[model samples]
Target: MSWVPVAVSLGFAGLTVLACCSFKVFLGVRRFGRELERTKRRLGPKHAALRDELHDLPEPRAARSPGDGVPSV
Candidate 1:
């Protein structure tokens, strides 16, 4: 029938659009992931240093004297 060719053409067109859209999404996700990784790598050392410093700090005590200039809030 004449309608068969039209149906096949429409199906192929839909498939092509779907494929293109999927490819774009995949590429965008890949790019975003790479950017995130790079940012993490850039901040990794600083974060590690901060963690070490926090770990090395002495625990707070309840016997604070005057002139400590530290706020208890």
Candidate 2:
């Protein structure tokens, strides 16, 4: 019936809620990290190959042209 007990109960309730929320957030972060690692591993070689192919393509003539009305100098 006293204010002290009421305040203590409210504080305990707030702490319990915070603990549960923190635990859920921790689990979500762990799961996301694992998924990101998996995705990076799966894409690594494919991305490298694509980058190589892109590099092998011939350069565009327009991109190399100078003073051709394309804001060159």
Candidate 3:
């Protein structure tokens, strides 16, 4: 039928568009992964320093009693 060629052409065009979109998405994901790795590397030392500082802090005190020279509502 005459419509068969038109159908085949449309199918090919659709596939081409889909493939291009897929490639673009793949590249974007790869770039994002690289940026994430770079950021992690840059902040690794700062993160470790903050973690160490947190550990060096003193422990919390026990809860105070309301009757310790204070009024108990």
Maximum-TM-score candidate: 3
> TM-score, each model?
0.78, 0.79, 0.85
Which prediction has more favorable lDDT, 1 or 3? 1
lDDT of 2 by residue, 1-73 (tens): 5999999999999999999999999999999999999999999999999999999999876565455566734
* Model 3 ranges off by over 4 Å: 66-73
Candidate 3 lDDT over 1-73, as tens digits, reads 9999999999999999999999999999999999999999999999999999999999988877766676756
Span of 10 residues, lowest total lDDT, candidate 1: 63-72
lDDT of each: 0.97, 0.93, 0.96
Q: Name the candidate that leads on lDDT.
A: 1
Query: Candidate 1: where is the Cα deviation over 4 Å?
Result: 62-73
Candidate 2 local accuracy as lDDT? 0.93
- Least lDDT summed over 10 consecutive residues: which range in candidate 2? 64-73
Runs in model 2 deviating more than 4 A are: 63-73
**Candidate 1 TM-score over all chains jointly:** 0.78
